[model samples]
Target: MNIVGQLAPLAFGLAVIGSGIGVGIIVGKTIESVARQPELQGRLSSLMFLGIALTEALCFIAIAVAFIPFPKP
Candidate 1:
């Protein structure tokens, strides 16, 4: 009901949006790389998954942080 409460959700929304963009970029680049060199598809795919996992982890961390109770000023 206060400013902090309102901003917490907004921050989480931004985090989610960022994660989505990060994932899109990762996949798009990976596809481009694989298209250029079909033989490197295996390596490129693994790296892409790693990047996506790390990117999604940010969203999870944001969700956890948003639920933490902040001390009232």
Candidate 2:
């Protein structure tokens, strides 16, 4: 197998791990802020969802890349 074939699993793993870490951080911080200032809950929730959506976009890209046909040697 060539480079793309070799790296696909690694790339997919990194994509999933990175996205999970990102989401965890986003959620943790959002909870901390909301706890401290309950009045900002609405704005914080919206921002959290935006962050999640953007992070998940990377996952979708990774999935697409995984589906690309590998050239036959």
Quote the positional error of residue 16 for candidate 2 in Å: 0.2
lDDT score for residue 53 of model 1: 100
**Candidate 2: Cα lDDT at 37:** 100
lDDT score for candidate 1 against the true structure: 0.93
What TM-score would candidate 1 get against the native? 0.90
Name the 10 consecutive residues with the lowest summed lDDT in model 1: 1-10
Error of 1 at 39 (Å): 0.2
Angstrom error at residue 28, model 1: 0.4
Kindly list the per-residue Cα lDDT of model 1 for residues 1-73, writing each as its tens digit: 5777888888899889999999999999999999999999999999999999999999899888888888887
How far out, in Å, is residue 47 in model 1?
A: 0.8
For this target, which candidate reaches the highest lDDT against the unseen true structure? Answer: 1
* True-structure lDDT of candidate 2: 0.91
Residue by residue across 1-73, what tens digits does model 2's lDDT show? Answer: 3777788888889899999999999999999999999999999999999999999998879878887986686
